[model samples]
Target chain A: MNGVFAKLRTGLAAAALASTALAGPVSAQQVKEFWHYLGAGGELEGVEGMMEVAKSKIDEEFTHRVVPGGSAGLRQQVQVSLMGGVPPMAYQVSAGLELNQLAQSGRLVPLTEAWEQINGDEIFPEGLIQVISYGDEKYGLPFAMSMLGNTWYNKGIFEELGLEVPTTWEEWDEVATTLEENGYVALTSGGGSAAWTIYQFYAALFDAAGADGYWEFVGGMMPLDDPRFVEAVDLFEAHFVKYFDDEWTGGVWSDGLDRLMAGEVAMYNMGDWASGYMRQRGWTPNEEYSFFPAPSLQNVTIFQSDVIVVLKGEETDLGMKFAAAAASPEAQQAFNAAKGSIAPSNEIDPSFYDPIAKMEYDKLVSEDAIVLPNLYVLMPSGFKEDLGNAFTRFGATKDRAAFDEELARLEEMRKEMYEAGEFGTF
Target chain B: MTTLNPLAAIPFRQRDRMTYFIFLMVPAVLYVAAYIYPTIETFRLSFFEWDGFSPPEYIGLENYWELLGEPRFRNAFFNNLKWLVFYLTLPTVTGLALALLLDAELRGSVVFRTIFFIPFTITTVAVASAWRWMYKPSNGVMTQFVEALGFDAPNWLGDPSINTYSIMGAALWAWSGFTFLIYFGGLRALPTELIEAARIDGAKFWTILFKIKLPLLWPSTIVVLGIAAVDSMKIFDLVWAMTQGGPYRSSSVLAVEMYETSFVMFKLGQGAAVAFVLLVVASIVVMPYIYHMTRQVDEVKE
Candidate 1:
């Protein structure tokens, strides 16, 4: 009688195990974890909006982790997570150097298959796609972009001086002189630690160096001592630096914009974000203030984009689906609309863009447009930092000898970095 | 009274020893985990080449060798030395002067003392930002004052040649209040008869101060100098918030270099190497004070 009871209990246990196995996957929902630098402000709203648009498209439920500290903070957190062997499915990273670093570390898997599925090659600019690519594989999906190299100016200041928007370097020189003669600060950028603002000067440099020269320079092929590069540097030192505010080094990027807004300064060379700053302050775009691409870079589109990078993880397939959603037109529209940045895709309608962003979109789609990644997103982080420092020093001193020495040092540094296999193809 | 005392059976001395041991155990474990272990790890990692993400490659002193060749590191090292010298001298002297001035018996002197000490009470970052605005080239208070005095106002924080000194000026302002408080306490605690005797001997005010008061203030001096030395070595928040070791690292110091290398440049091994160098240098600077204080305590006990 005891053996009969034991057999019955064992049979019941087997039936229960079978039922549990059948119910597990159906009952449990797969959660895809994503990391982003957007926490507070419009960026948070933007990410949330993007996720809302992407929710139906992606098969799995996803949770977004707001990583504080911008790109630097995101990089540090991602490093810690990767070291712990629990990297998130995807994270927001800049398109070029930041993404390349992770890809080179073997932490990120290529999203090329996903990219092809979204018709990314057809929609995104070729240069932008390359910026997000590592070696032969695509590692990032471009989402939002800001057009660089535009000179944001006070329309009030221009009207007071009767200066039309300069369409040529010579015309800009006259306009700058006129503004200066009228006792208005002609051109300015934040120096000191905020010296990276001087990369706007590189737009002019890019114009001096044609597409080929610019490519060679950024690709670590062209030496800084090259005559063409020197000429570009000379233009930056001579023309732009001539009109730079004597006290510019004391202020930061926002201060420069503030000066422009107050009509004390005539022009500021900054990214599209300056317009957002202006709009926030109740300054009407195209009426109170307006921007135009540097006359020399009128045909060249210098852009910085935020990208979604898929890391190696258990839920990589879901991560790819999210990347696809991020790259899709609907999601891009929703994200960029809230984020105050223009969509990376050319297919996105321009009706929703602000006046300045609309101008950027038109220029981006123009036949003559030669799109290039901004210097910040083009070179390795170390080299980029060194270059910014060099420029800041040169901005203050204007000593040609010291500038040349910096150039030589940077050339050698770039060579070493390239030899160490720290770069991707231009 | 017939009472059961569990610990009484143990000798008083043994019980006392156990009590001390129990008190020290937590801190000992914490010190090893928080300080000693991490320091050892930092020293070990300094010999490897790691970029935070990849497995550390054992490079074995290559990081140090490279640092020696790097111009930026040398610049930062010298800047740190400049900070050390300035901290050791300027704050000490200015604080002594202020203490001497405030030591006088006068009305409303306490209010003046409080006013001077206010800066020290503020956070370093706040102090830095305040000073940064005052050093702004265009409309800074300093610039406006100099310009109003019929002189051309040179760029305070913009000129690389002068920026370190400019920042040091701010540091002095922030830190002198601390030293002044110490010196004031030292002055108040002094025996009045000594100074009275010096005055009765026809000694001048200068002579009395130099020959009598200054020598007696050694303990306060030591306290101020020891703190200033360590503070100088680890100076980061001020320089970082103000100039970020820029106008091309002209104001760069060892601590700033360490942070930038580790977090900004993502060269963890190289950054650790910098941190180790800082630890060694700081230890060298602080060790003598530690020994001196411990020796004083031993003598007192004797």
Candidate 2:
């Protein structure tokens, strides 16, 4: 009986090997190439890891290529290629009204059917899903979600000063005062890069006032002349002028992180990806360093989601299949596990996350915080251009009344865009 | 020689004329195909609204209208003017002075000339990158030196008002060398008899330089000015590498603006319009100088 069993096992193994050999040679599945703007070391590693998994488990014959560059370079190159009529199969894009524009232009393949078939709506956060969906049709899949409105601080410094993490605007001011008095730079950030750092200040202000109301004002759904919006803007300007670095005007985001890591600064306002840098420098989360939502912002968190959009191509079916694979729970887990971001799909277990990441992930899942849409994404082309100019002027000039005037102009432009049916109503 | 008809008096045979036409036409046609055609195409594109990916929609002069209205474009245009004016004047003055000084018979003058020209040999990107590091507030050598001297270092690249100036300093460093070489060559060709006559007239050294040498060097100065003017008007790489037109739109020049509009903003028509505007502006500024210089050359020959 033992000899018979051994012979049967060997026969089955031989048959399996024979069948595998009879399978078509490699390069059977059409190759789908992608380009991305994820040039940071950790993000590149995460992408490579995902590629490895995809190659091993998914269509073995298919190939995945990644060309990485800085955001500006990638945006320029992608624009050139698309306008020249040679867009890649897949590319990294932010989810928002800009994406909606892309969809309307018919450059992107409508993934509504695939999304419905895969039940993507049920897995992704509703706000995120809504951001990527335009005209009641899905165009992309979310890959990573960021916790954008978080303050990262040196735990050692806070402990030395005997100050607890604050959870309110008043408390945050006190902490800033204490840190300043103690000969530490209270906060460090750069506004030179299109006023992105100012976003944190605005997010906090919006939180303190009211997130929904703030969005309505910025989106021009509410009157820009509203005194509440002015108050929020005033508060934002005050903190921006007060607690930021001495060279705030010249600062870059990477420089801020470097200062915090080098112990030259006390705290920084940044996204969760910052944790990856801290971890790389031999610091453990919640011990050497800790992060909390910007206390002054109330419960409003500014989040940005990374979404994958499939371009219209010859291999549309294969591209959709790969996109679906990218959206699968297994892919999300593998990607987010390496990426230090929350899996876009809610089905992934939060327990598998690192302790600090898990905390932010849990808060996002529970609170369902509002995702702030950048004006560039939400407004029409002309309006967005005008608004970008206005925002730059406002940030540089720091004249509140002038800023208000710009906001008014932006509101008028938004109204015109809406009237012209350029954008859907909120 | 036998008396020949006026038509036959021409130097070339009919066959030679055909060969000459072919020879000239080949290079001229190539130049037009490679350079002129693309420029014309880009100018044509300015009249059409296209994102570059899709087919362009004909929208005559709309891009130019929008560009004129856009405040950022205005700022960039003004910045380009500022760059051209300052860049042309400062470098030519410095280079001419240096070339005059080095033209004198002095010890180790060859070494001095080599040292002066060294910066120009370095790549523009490298020069920009090095300056960026030096201007860095945290780890820059200049910042550390300034801090050590018990002074606060201003954000060189951060301040909108001074950012272009800071980039100009780097550009001038690269440019002064080229001007020096041109002035050096001109000095070498100066008429010794004229200088001796000026000295005999009891003219002081300053008067000699201003009156005689300068007038003699006018041809070289014009050439240098023309090159520098064109270069400064089209300056892109150093500013892009250094400031990326940041700290608000303070450092933005027309070239950077054009690139951002065409590529970053994906407004190809607007970019094309900006490019054409830049071309016209550059032509307007340069043509008179070129004409005057050519006339000066003719006067010198006479």
Top DockQ hit? 1
Please list the residue runs of candidate 2 whose C-alpha ends up more than 4 Å from where it truly belongs after superposition.
Answer: A1-31, A57-72, A75-86, A208-211, A214-219, A278-284, A296-301, A349-355, A367-376, A381-398, A422-426, B1-15, B53-55, B143-152, B191-203, B292-302
lDDT of 2 by residue, A324-357 (tens): 7777777777778877888878787777698888
Instruction: Quote each prediction's TM-score.
Output: 0.90, 0.85
lDDT (Cα atoms) of all candidates against the true structure? 0.82, 0.74
TM-score of 2: 0.85
* Worst-scoring 10-residue span by lDDT in model 1 chain B: B48-57
> What is the docking quality class of candidate 2?
incorrect
Q: Assess each model's interface with DockQ, reporting 2 decimals per model.
A: 0.24, 0.19
Q: Over the stretch B15-114, how does candidate 2's per-residue lDDT look in tens digits?
A: 6887789899999999987988668777877987776445567899999998887778899999998888987799999899889999986789999899
